[model samples]
Target: MRLRELLDATELGLLLLVGHDTDDTDDNDGIPPGTPLDRTISAVATNDLSDPGRFLTGGELVLTGLAWWQGDGDAESFVRVLHRAGVTALAAGEVEHGLVPHDLVRACRRHGLPLIAVRPETSFAAITEHVLRRLHRRDPGSLAGLAALVERHRRLLTDRAAPDSVLELLRHTLGFDVRVLSATGRQVAGARPPLRAKTAAALAARYLAARRAGESAPHHVTVGGRPYSLVPVPAPAPVRVPVPGPGPLPHPHPHPHPAELGDWLLVVEADTSLWATPDRELLDRTVELVADARAAREQANTARNDLADRSLALLHSDVPAEEIPLRLRSTAQAVVSGVGYWPRLQFVVAAGEWHAARPVPAAALRVLLEEALLQEDGPVPVSSEDIAATVDGDRAVLLVLVPGPSEAHPDPALDHAALERRLSAALARWLGPADSVSIGVSSPVPEPGNARRALEQAHNALRIAHAAPGQVTVRGPEDLTSHILSLLPLIPAEARRAFATRLLGPLRDHDARHRTDLLTTLETFLDCDASWTACAARLHLHVNSLRQRIARIEHLTQRDLSRLETRLDFLAALKSG
Candidate 1:
């Protein structure tokens, strides 16, 4: 409140000589001096004192006693000072210094100074007290009122009544509009009337500038000639919980939104000085509510994503293989809408102990994968957990289910090469130098029931990834041979091991006795399929030596090399080994 404005309401014996407005007389007009001065007084004194420039401009009750003069010679000088200083009125004290000084009265009447006489017992302190009370009528009575409002607003927001409701409450009760924006200054929610845009823009800009300078710095802005104070809310990272560290400090960047991205701001705007004690307190509470809500929302999203991922894993197993396509379709609809039909299906998986420790938080991971798939400028659907992703035709599908094809891009023209590069780079940036991720991609196969096969193929490629070094995507059916063998549905683990032992028992014993090169020779010969020259070239041996080793093996095992059964047994043993 400006001093002039405060004084205007004080109605104590205030009269104006250089009055520009018609209502210059004190509000308590027609009242005599002895009638207890009941009004607030604020009269501007035009009279010059020792320091001529210190005149009150627009206050009530400017008093003059001709006290600055001793007689006639001084009286006229005093009147000249009063006129030049722009004093509104001069009250001449009679009893203290005798009846109104003749020269002073004559000067006041000549200059039209609304002059009054003060009695001997009048105290300035009594008048000052009356004025103070009137000026403070609307302000919060005590500090507690401000503190209470701040806490109340915080609790109201925590009740989960959307942000809009909170803003409405503030506007209705506080008589000002509110706006919420992201860290990037993008408006989240708020009223933006055309009339208030300029004012709002200026205030918002100033507040943001101050916040950027130092988030903890509180700023005051005047919009539409009305003052407003803005304080920034600190957005903490999702992983940063209230653990023991150096407790919470104001963020250097005063972005009202969450610092970790994808958060919002809580901006409160009100008339200057109208942000009573109560409003300031409520603002504090609002900040806490927003931070807690953001944190809770992040957690909920993580849990939901976890459940979806687990559901997908369940769909991948337990269910009969043939039902995979149907299952994928159902899950796809549940996770992302408008997705149906899949042409080419490729499965990919990343594994290792390193992957476990710093696993992508479910929501963040989901978002990253979705962002890669969608390439959209808007919000991407990612939970705060792990990134389990799928791609269907046009829609980069996410959420867990059988690796299936989508109708949008039915031709299973899998971009195996491009996808491998993307996965490598994304994981590299995400995991940093400490971790390693091995991605195995299944060759794009025909759609429908083959979804399960594609997933199995990808899984197999991942299993044998060690064999192919420096590779992220181990694709194609060949990479998964070991897995194929396991899926034979005919040979149990123990039986397969026993069979491998029986067939290679002769060669094992022979090698053990003579330290012979029989196993190498057999593997090479079998790889060459009885071609002596090629087998010898591969073994780096003379053809004759190779023949001798082969003959010795045959003699010991009692299985002729020329026979189909003997060759089949050797081949099976080699495969198992």
Candidate 2:
């Protein structure tokens, strides 16, 4: 406690002769008047000796009964020792000596230490008891203060405060470093100074895994060798209890089941096992506040998502080019700030395998794409600005704003390629190797007027990706072969079969009737780049025999194999079959 507080306390009010600085200077023994009274009295030491410095560890309100005083020199020596030992204040009892001597007061004033005169009736033990009581009372007082702070935060959340604002309040009031993460392990808020993307992802994955395993929350886990408490903030209760009604009562689910997804997590930087009851209670309240904030944020996001979906639908419709920009202005501004015009646009389509009856997890893919966009090392770090929509049950489409030439690293292709790589890796982790996901990215379009074209391109690319060997396939304008192959799927099955039959029907019938290898020879000849020697070696036939089979194939199909046009037609017909 401050010396002034001790002097003013009711228990010590009768004890007079409190020392004060005579000068007008603001210094009160190097401690200002407004200093907190929270400093603990480490111990109370009573000494009559001229040298009592060895027993003091500073911050003690030392008490002396003046039994060892002989003259001014003894008083000076005692005061100097107390001051040198870093005593906070001096209390001199006037019981035995009848009055506090002028020499000790002068010595205290010279040394800049506050001196208190203890009444003859006040015992040394009484003063020590008072100090200890006040010090011990601070713990409960601090707990009450913390509870009040938490209540204020809860009120702020109820008043519709921003989630980050509530988190900032908690950090400032409680002095705890904390973060809130989504179910996908992406940071939702409270990443001041920002955790590394990988670290955040790891923490999120651990939290989700624990929840999936039915482990209770506010559990402890170590990240980067520092212990943190993972507290699950469940979704808000859907049904409220009635006021003792007579009808069938509603069963409210207060807790989330393990299978229910999208629950957020609070990651406190300290282990809860070491926390006191009040601290634990405060943490529980913090989780509730975060959940409320999250619910509100999700509501806002739903509105934004609705806007984006409508904007995309309009762009894909028969809207005029001039009218398209007007309709997309609000959503484009919302998705990517500070853009008067989205000069370039790229479309991305993502899909995964599921049962024929079960819908693909397009929502999960959207979350994954959004998280990938937040990665600092990702190719398109600006992906966070992109608008992603679950266009259908099986697919999600992203409308990305391409950086302009004046912007830094303005190469959109490189950025898109990098995003493709990172996204594929993340998807591979989410959906194992046996299950697959394919993402197709289109070449940049010039404006929103071309959104329909971009969407079609992205869709066609996705078809090619599904047929390709790997989990991801990007088909730009340069990939003419995949593009042509992608277009074939658009043809009706009857038409494709008719085309194949018209070109290869005679060969198939001849092979079946005569039990000859003409069809195989033709395929081998085409595959060997029309080289008679290679075709003959591959088929284990003489060059003359291969030549005879080729001649037979050309005569039956009525198409010259030597011409490039006929060669391509034969190849296409073979693929279609």
After superposing candidate 2 on the true structure, give the runs of residues whose Cα lies further than 4 Å from its correct spot: 1-142, 154-165, 168-176, 182-188, 233-264, 299-303, 315-343, 353-360, 375-391, 407-437, 464-577
Q: List model 2 lDDT by residue over 64-105, tens digit each.
A: 778789776778888877767667778888887888898987
Candidate 1, residues 1-577, lDDT tens digits: the string is 2233323443444322222223233332332222122223332221224333322332234444344657675656665555554444455555446666677666655554445555455433333334334434544654353345445655755655445544544443333556665433334455454224334435444554554344443456666665555555444363222212233424343222212222244555543344335546656665566666555545445543543464447555788754766776565446443555542334555443122233223322233333233211212222223234532221122432223335754323334454455445433322323333344555443444445544554555655663454524334444454444454447676876787788788889889899988988888876554546557777899977987998898887878775434654677677775
Clashing pairs in 2: none
CA lDDT, every prediction?
0.47, 0.62
Worst 10 residues of 1 by lDDT: 375-384
RMSD of each: 24.0, 18.4
What TM-score does prediction 2 earn? 0.50
Candidate 1 structure, TM-score to reference: 0.32
Q: Lowest summed-lDDT stretch of 10 residues in model 2?
A: 251-260
Q: Residue 178, candidate 2: how far off, in angstroms?
A: 1.2
TM-score of each: 0.32, 0.50
